[model samples]
Target: MEQDVFRLHYEATQARVEEALREQIGRMGRYADLREAMEYSLMAGGKRIRPVLVLESCRMCGGDPETALPFACAVEMIHTYSLIHDDLPAMDDDELRRGRPTNHMVYGEATAILAGDGLLTAAFQALTQADLTAQQRVDAVACLSLAAGPEGMVGGQAMDMAGEGRSLTRSELEQLQSLKTGALIAAAAELGCIAAGGSPEQREAVRRYAQCLGRAFQVQDDILDVTSTDEELGKPTGSDREKEKNTFVSLLGLERSRELVEELTAQAVAALDGFSSRDFLVWLANTLAQRTK
Candidate 1:
């Protein structure tokens, strides 16, 4: 398929996921202030890649997107919550995200923290409400819980914090990226498999694909930080340098980083060979490898 066709598919899926997100958020309990803050960041414009991955992975498994919408929204909520907390004064301390003020910058530290907390817990609620079988829901919940828990994303974050202002070896950086970013991406793909009642072999294949794609995603992000403008990125540029962080770009330079992305993209695409209808997933990996933002 042409790039234009893939772009259209991505846009359409993104819109659908956005609507699902709004509906899920609307069902939240009445806590005006907390809800407002939560909505502020949750509704903030993003690529919605995680949710798209969920929907697309389900499609790849011959499952219905409607059946996957709940899990898709849940992953996005978790992602949005992570971004809110990551932008706090104590974290990256950025004042901008998705071309607007950071959640804490606009809503205050307390509300921002609460908003992140709300979204985090809401993710589980969203999972519980997914339209899957009892056993499927149980498996999906367990998968997501492991990915978001202390041993996964949280642990990766802790390592990231510990490595701040210090140069890390390539292996250490890869380990951090695998947990902090790759874990959730892996879960998104895994959730799609679980939601679709995919066979164990299919589940493992997408997991491998997501692992490579997730690392590529982060590598591209690092590329964008230096190469993309704040307008394109919707956030401050050169932040990695400003924070003195060890990113793929910083460690490998532009040329080498691009090579790494290509390598990972190929690996991700190859992992999809176990499936018959994987054009979208393949195109997505290549597109992400070359994305500016």
Candidate 2:
């Protein structure tokens, strides 16, 4: 039963994301080359998990998924932008992403950089154009800005760069991962609340749930990097170890990290206890913790 819900949400959200990507890309008039490059990277395969979170959260709050689609796409664009930049030659220096050549590898460094920039700007544009109440728009914009801004994803990236090749306390590592990875996930949930006109208390509940899920998601990713193959992960595995980056799996044993993931998953599900529409969210949280990729 839970698997059915997961599969349904996953497939439905995937289709929505693809449609949004096509529509968004089509609007990029002129500068056709840059637009193509941007679309290439954006359309590159991903699980579309962030956008799905946005839609699911809105659905759980008794909102229309159609109304939430723009914000959902916006979050995905931001996530894709981060990935493009993260794979840059001066950054992670990754040669592959989503089982294909990195943006820089195919489009050149300058083009890749521009592609990332375009996607970031486009995300805000998409959010601003969402068909929502003025207040909802304002809140959604604020949530997205905070998640993508210096206090969140960018700050986290800075910390990650600083911590590379250095030892970090478990707390410090968690903090960095929370900001870098968890912020966007939390924003997904928060935007859903805004779109649904949820009360502050309800939004807070969803935020907490997403935060726990995001932490567990990142830790599981770390574990997969050590244990899964590149094909299975859709990117290079063991890259963290190769770069000597501190990860949960590096600081804690694999068994310990797995245990932590299960604990976090429980906390995430527990956060949704009072919500009336929680079945899909619960299933998503559990599936994320246990996924091979």
Candidate 3:
């Protein structure tokens, strides 16, 4: 697998997910203003890595991309909602995201909050309408619910807020991020496996892979917060320091953080060995480790 080939595939997958998101959003609800707010944030794009992981993992496990499309879009919707809420004045209080004004800045705080709620509910609706067995749908809903609910990302956010202005131990920081970041990523891979009707062994391997990749991604982001420009990050740099929150680069030195990234990347790639076709996932893990933004 050439880097060029992987790049092409990655772009194509991102496009596919966005297209599905746009199409599905049109059908989400009839309230024009609400839909406008929802569309604003949902279409404000990023790498679409989460949805891409869902589709690719499904394909890798011998499922049709179409079969995974709705769920992938659902995951993207959930992610976008989280971002909207995370940027509110009560949260990170940032005014910029993805090189544009934050949702609250553009749409007012009330609409921004409703927009996030709308997207969250719409995501669950998409899940209910997905083409899966009754049992599969039940399990998928349950898994994603746990990942997005107070038990996972929300819980981690609570810990983050509580730990603000205080130094967290390395283990405590890892525990927080594992839920805040790693949980949904792990769910993305597991959902793909479920979508494909993959074996239990395959599910475990991909989940392990996603967990490491998610951690590496966050660690690199923490590193970037210190080293990259605001232009590169599309938001304020040194935010971790401003908030006095513990990060990989904060808990561990820059040199030590880089070492951990290397370790995590290796572990992530190793977890994919069981799959016969894993070049993209491998390349993806390594590329994320070295990303500038």
Candidate 4:
């Protein structure tokens, strides 16, 4: 029953984010193909976890979740753009995403790159046009830039590429995942706190929560790639092993990776020690830890 309620809330949040994303894309004019490509990837179905974090964090911090809709949409856009690029031939070279052809696979590689660019720029555009205080917009943009920029996800990708075919220590692996996956997620939670006018201390607490949650998410992904079938993952599994990438499972073995996930989830939940209305976030962490098998 509790799981059902969490799913209901999660679905409701996902629906709200999708609606706003559609409305945001509708504002773009001309460049039919670009728009189509952008819409294709942007509308691709997923859990909308980042945007949900934004909304839920806002609510938990005593703000109107509705007012955070634009920021939430922007966060989702950034996340989608990253996924599109990550699937390109130059990156993970994936042909499928979210149970369908990847943007590059369908639209060709060049257009897929442009589509990613379009979504990235559109994220900032949405932020600039959102009904937010100037400071809020600035804070949100700064937060996202750090997460998505050279020192964050992109940097982590560079590190991952460099470290390929070579074994990595557990700390190195953790650092890579923190940047590659945890940065944007931490930004999502912090952006929510920013939207809610949360205190610096409160925002920092949520950031810690998101950072641990993000690391747990990647560890879980690593485990799933080894344990789950492609049909269950909606994309090719074992790509991690095929690519010889350093992962939690590769570094610490499957059982230890599972233990790490449990530890990370507990840390994430404990970070919200003082926040009211945090049961959903705690449940969300547990759900990710137990995503499959």
Q: What are the Cα lDDT values of the candidates?
A: 0.91, 0.91, 0.90, 0.90
Q: State the weakest 10-residue window (summed lDDT) of model 3.
A: 28-37
Cα lDDT of model 3 by residue, 93-114, tens digit = 9899899998999889999999
Off by over 4 Å in 3: none
> For model 4, how does the per-residue alpha-carbon lDDT over 26-141 read when each residue is reduced to its tens digit?
98735858888888999988888999999999988888888888889888999899999988988888888878999988888888999899889889888776677999998889
Give the per-residue lDDT digits (tens) of candidate 2, residues 87-200. 998989999888899999998999989999999999988888889988898889899999999999999999999899999999999999999999999999999888888888
List TM-score per model, in order: 0.98, 0.98, 0.98, 0.97
Clashing pairs in 4: none
Model 4 misplaced stretches (Cα beyond 4 Å): none
Cα RMSD of all models vs. native, in order, equals: 1.0, 1.0, 1.1, 1.2
lDDT of 1 by residue, 1-293 (tens): 49899999999999999899899879884775888889999988788989999999999998997898999998999889998998889988889988899999888999999999999999988988987998988888899889987888888998999999999999999999999989999999999988999999999999999999999999999999999998888878998999999999999999999999999999999999979999999999988887887
Higher-lDDT candidate of 2 and 3: 2
